[model samples]
Target: DMYQMISDDNPYETPMMIFPASHYTMGGIWVDYELQTSIKGLFAIGECNFSDHGANRLGASALMQGLADGYFVIPYTMQNYLSDQIKVPHFTTDAKEFDEAEKAVRARIEKLMNIKGTKSPDQIHKRLGHVMWDLVGMGRTLQGLVKALAEIEEVRKEFYTDLRVVGRADDLNTELEKALRLEDFLVIAKMMAIDALNRNESCGAHFREEYQLADGEAARNDKDYMYVSCWKYTGDNEKPVLLKEPLNYTEIKVQTRNYKS
Candidate 1:
């Protein structure tokens, strides 16, 4: 399209490569009004925080969000938390308390290196993207979600067992970094599928095929799912627990959104 715009060629008539993608669909780490996460002193801002937008992010919302957070919001809110830590001492990375933590991280990296697996972190990442897009993205279904869970679990196993890295962990290795990130991404993917499966209702961007109106619109079950779901991670072996905080619309009316209007 950029080429078409600059040149004399027509945009539609010219051959163009296209890639389908979800544009800021519903999902982000939960945070309070001050952009503070459940963990104390930790903050997530802008796109990282799930404070704004209940479902779909409106056009130019990200722009407005960035402006509000960067210029107005976080500067004031973050100070409210930082003022309490004026007397608190900061721990450096080389601190004695970080010894156990550092050891754990090093041990994990060593375990990954010793696996001597065949697949690269990049390869598994692509596979994971496809799995998420096909099974967990857009139109989520019960059967598909269940299948995705199983497939993701298997993929997770494959990562630990047959992974291969280009360089040593102690060196400047992007592959090792990617492997660490992919490990976390796999966890998040599982959580997304679990959230989708448990909801059992279609609301906003989360469209479950089984739950819809006669007019082919999203059908929200306010009675049961009238709340924000908070998932707590227990461990890699155990299922996450679900917590709900009910939403009350005292001033504004809540109802199904008809895009046709």
Candidate 2:
């Protein structure tokens, strides 16, 4: 019920608090050892980048990655980058680029608010969440995936026409914030669903309904799908770039994962 409220296909009526559903990767910008993103003079450390986790992440490794990047990596890389720039030039808030970026942000918010739709933003968010939780949340199957894709399309249609935002563009509105986040979540949710559907065997968090052992445990087909699937988002209509990063095990021999006693 809680998950439904925050991630339902339709807008939620009662207010609810949503927990972090899965991995958090909002911290990485395009950074070097200095932990900087593509933007010059900007730095990102901790859980923000794609550097640490290679496909399926292990527990407690997040802490190590954060410490390594912040304490060890960034200091050295930042020093190298900063060595050449002795006197840094300061730019005012009214700079042309800054103004343009700010204007763009404001305009986007305005557009969302001005959308005279019948369905509320919460409605679309809930529908998307339901699809993700049911199809790509924990377990998956081909049939579920097909259903999820169809449901997502329906919800997306509602998002553009029925979805409503009840707040001013300039004000600090939590509802508007939620709407924007939902948009990103919807995109990511589909990616996860597709990734799970394409993977035939079960591995790590990806558990396919058709792929399981006789003892009722997840079965891995390492021979066929022992590589990490990396997806790059292209444009809206264009297909994503699919890349493979193979996993070779030397220290730990390949063995079936089991927890049954």
Candidate 3:
């Protein structure tokens, strides 16, 4: 009865919209054994880093992953890297690097403000949400993925030129922030689309419709795709390069999941 009260189709009486939305991503920024990112002096933990969870994480395990990384893993592993950075002095607000970064941000904000377009960022993002939901949400196919990529690119162009942001760069404007975030979302959307296209097999939550068996179960091509697909940012609107790290299974034999049995 309690379960039925919270489900989409409650046989017991109450019905609700309980379908899965974008909540967890087993795919994330790649990290090494030390939880260190590709960039030195940078580290990622928990859901942000693509570690521990693999491509498919079991339910209720994300909290454990976060706790382990925060309390146990990072404390020990980060010291190894941070110990070498003791000599580097603290940076000043007026430093050249800081100034350059600030300038870049200012330029971006100015561009957003000066767009002078009709559609608001939120409107464009809603359209983006629809695009992702239909093409890359759950059931994916090669043809759908290709179309999604093209549509996402169109969205990106429209976002830059047709965007409307009515706020000052120097002032506290939530709309401006939301607009900037939408820009990032578009970039990430494109990258995800490319990644999905490259991965021909269906493993974990990334189910490619074309890569399933006769029984509609996921068909994994472990021999060819038994490696991590890491994407590196090249430039704005440029294609990302995919690097692989082969997975070696010495202890356990990988097999299809059996939920019915």
- Which numbered prediction scores highest in TM-score against the true structure? 1
Q: Write candidate 3's Cα lDDT for 1-261 as tens digits.
A: 545645546665653434333543336677889999989879998867768875456444667888989999999999999888988898879879999998899898898999989989899999999999889876789999999999998998898889998877789998899999999999889888889889999887788998888887889999889987878889875778888888899999888774434
C-alpha lDDT values of all predictions: 0.84, 0.72, 0.83
Off by over 4 Å in 2: 1-107, 250-252
The better candidate by lDDT, 1 or 3, is 1
Best by lDDT: 1
Q: Rank the candidates by TM-score, best first.
A: 1, 3, 2
Of models 1 and 2, which has the larger lDDT? 1
| Stronger candidate by TM-score (1 vs 3) | 1
For each of the candidates, the C-alpha root-mean-square deviation to the true structure, in angstroms, is: 4.5, 9.4, 4.0
The TM-scores of all predictions, comma-separated, are: 0.87, 0.69, 0.86
Clashes of each: 2, 14, 0
lDDT of 2 by residue, 1-261 (tens): 545654774435644443333453122334555677767777777666657763345445667878988888888888777887787787789889998998888887777777778777777887787787776665678899888877887776777666688867668888899888877776776677677777898776667878998876898998989886778899655678888879899899888757554
- Ten-residue region with minimum lDDT total, candidate 1: 16-25
